[model samples]
Target chain A: MMDRMAVTTTTRVAELHELLARHETSPAAGNVPVHPELVELFPRGLRTGAVYSLHGSMSAALALLAGPSAAGSWCAVVGVPDLGIEAAADWGVWLDRIALIPRVPAGEWTSVVAALVEVSALVVAAPPEHISPGEVSRLLARLRTSGSTLVVLGNWPRAVATLTGQVTRWDGLYDGHGHLRGGSLRLEVTERQRTRYADLELPVRP
Target chain B: MISAAPIRVLLLWCPGWPVLAARLVQGIAADRALALTDRGVVVACSPAAQAEGVAVGLRVRQAQHRCPDLVVLPHDVAAETRAFEPVLRAIEEKIPDVHVVRPGLAAVKARGAGRFYGSEEAAAHALLTHLQRFTADELRLPVDLRMAVADGLFTAEHAAYSSSARQPLVVVPTGRSRDFLAGLPVSVACDRRLANLLQRMGIRTLGDLAKLPRAQVNSRFGAPGLRAHQLASGEDSPILRPRVVPPELGLHVAFDPPAAQIEQIVLRCEPAAEGFVQLLTRSALICTEIRVTVQLEPDALFERLWRHPWQFGKTEVLDRIRWQLEDLATEAVTTDDETLGASVLSVQVLPESVDNAEHHAQGLWGDRPDEKVEHALTTLQHRLGHESVLTSTVAGGRLLHERRVLRPWGDALPTLRERRLEQPWPGTVPGPSPATVFSSASQVQVLSADGAPITVDERGTVNERPTWLRTHEGQRRIEQWAGPWPIRQRWWRKVKQLNRFQLVDNHLTAWLLLSDGAVWFTEARYD
Candidate 1:
């Protein structure tokens, strides 16, 4: 199944490259780059002015931002105080440009997010419990106008894409004697805009 | 062979400037007698006080006795300098390079400006004219302003001092400075003791002093005498080097209909921001301090100074503008509308301090991964908030939580620690650190094999080794365990002590447990 997904993604990427060549413009003109492992999940690359919802694995979501962040784009993580900085650094998320606002007041969350979007290219946030659909829509509008991408950690109504990760197997530990060196996770990405789905198993390193 | 002649210098002098500055701030009438006193001595007195017999170096009581109605104000150096800032700005508008000698005095190289303004005389006249107009129109004070041009700073200052209010300017002809100083008193060359010595030697005037043999004067007066002889002979001192004036690059934007919304104002400022950054890049200069001015409707103005830890680019500029506008909008709503008013008529960005960009540019040999990260982090901080992004640093302490410190980005790392890390922390848990530290320790129950609750004694001893752990997740058998170390802190004052134990569960999850003689609390988890 993984091989089939890879073949289908390669064909889609080839078609995209042809279209891009005909247009005579760079593919990165209006897109944010993603990790090579996530190429099968987002064959055309992540859109610059859109939102994606990632569930289950925080490390996987952070890995998705490594490429763009390392390429000189600023990223912010909001409302996640317990986020392990060591884990983030291990996944190649440049800690220098990664802003972490552990918590924000519910009433000021929208404005804070808007402010962050004005300066940062990518903002990963967990929406507060009291946020309404109207507020989210307004934030999305601002994000679109500013050409910033939003990566939501939980369910975001009408998200452009949704990604979920499930750990398949844990390795490097025998009867708790050895350290937990790494693991394997099955990442399932579903695109709401194209009604397409892709799944791939990737290594998870802590 | 002959070297080039010395450059001409121009001096602008404002006599009794400290008294004038103090009176200006206090709104005292010009005709009133005012004396600035420092530590019971009169440092400076106004013209009115001088007329009544008050003078500098006089005791405050003596001045008061001389002039009964004298207003004695304490001398404030900062106020004098602050009042002089406007005068410097006015002079800089016409002249590119001007050096402030002190609060009441300023000097500039006259050769370039003289040629530009037709002659040395014309330059002095033009500067005096501009200053007189500025004092009359802007300052609205009748001040005694004087200007003079000559071959050196000392002669120029002397000429400015000798000029009367009617003329207010004196220009000594080029290459004739020695002749101009020939008739001046010997006291102008040195202190009273040297003047007395010169007088005793029949040298009553500067020309007489200049006529003495150089070696004879040097042998008698040492370096001070030689310097005085050089000055009297109209030779310029090598210490007075002219300062280089940097180019001023400022960007301004005026709204046609005036903008009130923060977003609209930010959008309008985009072009100016881009232009400002481009200009700085072209000049190879990086601005570290930015002065932003916001003009409001009907004469209300908002101004603020912003500083950057590193060089500021277009994104940082735009972010600061938005933040300032948002703050102003809030003020308008909370305060009276008449004070803050509505709408922004114009916005100006002026770089207050700049440095050569080449000095701070990244190297070409190695990859600067840290630089890229810092750039991104600062941009995010500009947008979100300064305190939102933080970096963790290890501090010296006995406890794990106390040793960890989180500081905002761009702040200097703390160097001082509460306790030395090299010292042995007797009660601290040894080995690898925990993966997760709970904000608050969770309560747990540890029981012996006989189904009795395990506890610690005041003597720092545990009841049993074999145990079952009951946590929020449910009961589990202990696989391996070590430690019942006791820590006594503030025992004399608060009387607090804790016994720490390291235990592993059946699931192989290690836990650091703390007991205060009663209950067990899970402090951290090693995953």
Candidate 2:
């Protein structure tokens, strides 16, 4: 009976360590605030020093930028030549504090982004056509040291979370009739190997 | 405050100095009809131009019509100041404490010079002789100079202006300045509106203005009028504070055999940059702007003024030099000038503006947090060209592309001419703004349900409803569609009539498409 109890106790200790490990590695406990609507997905807000990959939607990426930007944090957008500033402003971004670098040459992409990560609270960029893993790690090191979050428009390897969104339903448009007023966005959020789903409206109302 | 006995001042005046400076710097003949214009209005004119009725305050076209052969040049203040520097230096050799009133005028106290020379009149003549010799012998451009010595700066300046070419020096006897200035017009007080008001009040001459009771003048005309009254009555005790000559802070770096690469020049300038900052620190000042003058071998000279948001450090100075060299290198490829491709011989770094260190002191708490971000942006600007890093403002326009205005970081945003965001730009795409706006529109094929090309008419009617959108990726069936919102702009100049459409495809993503009657283009995406 003592041997069986010891075995059970050992399993209990192992389970507790596993829980502690997950908590320690997860960035969900970070302090940077997200939008109130996004609180369900990010319980503790956006994690500083964490890389978040976005897929199939630029508006979703802009929605992420709008939160910290409205909260008076400086944000930078690099390599997104056609980023809509009006849409960002519509989503409640403070345009005055945002830096928009439309293009960084392929060769200077890593260094430029690394330098930018040192100062801004959040950096949004489209990953260049080709980037080495070594350069990515160097940039990630800077992000960790500076406590700045990196939001990638395209896929980024080793991102802490990946956000994929699609326009599931669009409102206020018909066959040769009304204009595009608002729409519904279906979001698939994956963090720490777990996936969750969310549905929200475009141009999130104040 | 007016003292009982106003100190004596000697004034030197040069009329039409802008025209003379143009002649000296631009090689324009001063004897010909010449006028200097600022913003299309004549600011100054030469004797020949004045004889042709081309005077100050005349528009450029009017002056040109009056003279017919008038040589009009844009007034450049820097060139005027640069050409006047040697003349000021020449006078400084004779008068130890000369105060420059303007580029063309200077003032000095007459008491010390009078004591050194026999009399105030002799001191004035000695100063004039010294300037004439310097201009005639050294500069080779002899100027028509005038001098006056009187009880106060206002009367001394007026006396110098009133002196003729024949009698270039005018001296008012002590305590007789009021009598000397009595015959001059009230406009000599240098207040145009006040002079116009006084003229309407029948105070045409300085003597008429001086005859008014002082208390009455104070009560009726206010402070400026009372000061004008004091000037007319010779009670203007103007303070003549001598200007300290600026120390030599400019650095010259010469690369022997010339620098072939920008990095080489930047490397060589490291020590010079350190020394430049040290020089400013020693003077208890900081440089905020610098003029980098680069000289290329065989004769191409280029200079650009670089302004820093904060005081320039050694690294910033070096970065500016590197950026300038890189800019010159790029210009060489586009321009046909072979001299620009030649090696760079030397560079001159001159401080354009310097401020006291006390004004730039750090706060008691710490530096503002925006500085780190600002510095980072500046670093990015150095790596990329100045126009690469930008801050955007949502300006007013019908199209998505035209609505957002991008300004280079650290540059002053141009005033929104008429495109203010508050204006109700009618017929714009309604509702939520698109997320991705193409910098330049990309062509797309829009077809009807019957697989025929779609077009819009001038009357804002679509020939057929667009049911399919064909991009480079593939064709997508339209789920819903709207808009033939006609955008007509600049109809009198280049008439642009465009019909816009909003289409939601099978994937549920919306696209903002524009049709210029025949061709269709995707302007933005709601994704």
| Candidate DockQ scores, in order | 0.05, 0.29
lDDT of 2 by residue, B24-85 (tens): 99887658998999999999999899898988999999999999999988999889988888
Q: On residues B267-332, what C-alpha lDDT tens digit does candidate 1 reach at each position?
A: 889999999997776666778788899999878878987776567789778877876776786677
- Best TM-score among the predictions, by candidate number: 2
lDDT minimum window of 10 residues, candidate 2 chain B: B361-370
Whole-model lDDT per candidate: 0.73, 0.83
Give the top-scoring candidate (DockQ).
2
TM-score: model 1 vs. ground truth: 0.44
Model 1, runs deviating above 4 Å: A1-206, B1-4, B10-12, B18-27, B36-42, B51-54, B57-142, B145-149, B162-233, B237-261, B279-286, B291-304, B325-370, B379-384, B390-527
**lDDT (tens digit, per residue) of candidate 2 on A17-101:** 5654563322223556676667788888778888999999998888888778876777899999899989898888888778889
The TM-scores that each candidate's chain B achieves against the reference are 0.53, 0.78
